[model samples]
Target: MEISMSTIAFGFIGFKATDFAAWDSLDYISKHRDQGEWTGLYIAEDEATAKGYLSDKINNSGNGIAYLHKVSVIRPGKLITCLDQSFKTGNIDIPALKQAMRDKGINVEDTDKLTEKLGQLGYYFRCFNNEDGAIEMIIPVELVTNVDMQLYKTCIAKSFVFSCQ
Candidate 1:
């Protein structure tokens, strides 16, 4: 599909650690590693600029898929979250982000696979464009069990901070 400059420029924001109790958007999941649940708190950027840009992203595509074909970011001191998953791998050197294209069906990806080949990579919240110019995100295995958050691990399976839909 041909993407106009306006469409390409549009995108949504994922406030991974933010929560919106007013909107009732937060889930009740306890574990970040649980299946099909977002494990972190994420805020939607509703500012006019963000909302407008994101609107374009939503209309210009079908679904969003994450691709990890680049290993350059695999080094230490950085956290990589899986916003989408669509790539071939071994040691997961991964691929560079391709030019933004029409959204496709959201890919079902596991966080463990990406973290399996790294030396020092911690998982974190990721953001991308899916329907409505927003994509889903999840924490990698490295960030699954935090030493400090162990007490509240049994909260449920809804964290919205990072996980699946």
Candidate 2:
């Protein structure tokens, strides 16, 4: 489960060899695979690639994939996905999240202010636990727009989160 989630996240950065997006668009793309194929969100680079993959799966393996969807992974705003068990107890692993951001060359000082700014923009953290003893923070792509660049640039000196092709 952890591996699947990480793979999905990495897809946003174009790390997957064959791009695969969820057939149901954003609805199934972020869900766990245990919920069945219909609920599983696959990652793809674009619509053509996603369609090709879907065709192959249905033709070759008789997969019940009748529809394909194109979703916009690129958003004007950014949401941080944090995986930590402490979130289940209503506590956030702020230090870990900040350190991860720092490792990505994003300036994450003034953590409180950073979160506050995100909250002001209606991009609050949504925590999820798959009973894997870790919480995953995910934001719907629709709600990931209207970013305040002024505050974003202040906290992030450099980051791929805001860079998309």
Question: Local distance difference test, per candidate?
Answer: 0.27, 0.34
Span of ten consecutive residues with least summed lDDT in model 2 = 148-157
Q: What lDDT is reached at residue 153 by model 2? A: 11
User: In candidate 1, residue 137 scores what lDDT?
Assistant: 34
Worst 10 residues of 1 by lDDT: 147-156
Model 2 accuracy (lDDT, Cα): 0.34
Q: How many clashes does each candidate structure show, in the order listed?
A: 21, 8
Choose the strongest candidate by TM-score.
2
Tens digits of per-residue lDDT for model 2, 1-165: 011112122113211112223223333334432342112122333333333343343333443323343333343444445545555564655666656656755565543444443334444343434333433333333233321111001111122121112
Mark the regions of model 1 whose C-alpha exceeds 4 Å error after superposition: 1-30, 34-120, 135-137, 141-165
lDDT of 1 by residue, 49-158 (tens): 12323222222343322111101111223333333433212122233221222132212233333332221234343444344445433334343222111111111122
